[model samples]
Target: MSDKDSESISDAELDRQAEVWEKIAHRPEFEKLLTAKARFIVPACVFFLVYYFALVVLVGWFPELSKKRIGPANLAYWFAFSQFFMAWIVAWIYVRAAGRFDRLSDELLGEHAQPSETPEK
Candidate 1:
């Protein structure tokens, strides 16, 4: 595309858009969205990290307990394998939670969006 065509919005239009977004950013709905996301994300992250590291700690500190076999694999192996399932479960939960977050975001943006004035080519 030529530069003229590529440059869609004028600087003034861009400035107006920035101001609209600035206003949106200060709204209570924006704060609610951020807080909701952080609430879910922080706990999920901490839980996963603790679960992941517990295996290492168990193997190092209680080798006998971790080495006790159940079929062909030991406790450590089972624990490690379970982490895969844990990760998948976490991902599933996050996906469900993210749908709610996205809806809230969409509503927030819809409420704040200004009518576009398309610059003619």
Candidate 2:
């Protein structure tokens, strides 16, 4: 449908459409996907935050520990650099997890996903 056709849809029709979608959203398959996503995301975020702040707290509290040498660069410098690697590792892990999430989502929406003659962009 064109943008104008969509815009012309009345409030009552929109409300009815939303209600239908809301019912679908509450189905068991959708809930399972949501739970799976949350199970990975919540703990992963918490781990990242805690590790980041722990490094900050350690650096602030014990300057001597941070200043200790590891070859040329100090311990703190190594630790600081590792934070970037940590973020990248977490992102990589999430990317891997997203494959599972996408599969679950596809399974949940498979019945509702309308078949098209042409491939979607």
Candidate 3:
């Protein structure tokens, strides 16, 4: 085959692949997933930042809150330990939100439909 013919074939294949990808990307279910991700990510980010800053401010401004007496551990060390608890709380919140989002998307997409029954059934 001529070089031109091979180039045309490659172009056609590329176009076909692009169209398939476009369709998949534009599917309603895919769009819903994207929306759900955006919803989860934005709020989770805000919450994480707020929680982190609050922890920092509380540790800096409130000595009583950070006070600690576990052997050589200082108030800052205890406060740092509490930050892990806050991290777990944020993780739980994110997981819950993501689960809710997934459920909503599945419902919206009618993903709970059972498989088609055979004539024998």
Question: What would the per-residue lDDT of candidate 2 be over residues 26-104, giving only the tens digit for each residue?
Answer: 8788888899899999999999999898789879999999999999999888888889999999999999999999988
Where in model 2 is the C-alpha error above 4 Å?
A: 1-14, 114-121
lDDT of 2 at 112: 62
lDDT of 2: 0.82
Q: Mind giving the per-residue lDDT tens digits that candidate 1 earns over 2-110?
A: 2664357788876875676677677898889999999999999999999999998998999999989999999999999999999999999999999999998998868
Off by over 4 Å in 1: 1-22, 115-121
Clashes within 3 Å, all models in order: 0, 0, 0
Compare candidates 1 and 2 on lDDT and give the better one: 1
| Candidate 3 runs further than 4 Å off | 1-9, 53-81, 101-121
TM-score of each: 0.74, 0.74, 0.51
Alpha-carbon deviation at 2 in model 2, angstroms: 12
lDDT of 1: 0.86
Candidate 2: deviation at residue 59, Å?
2.1
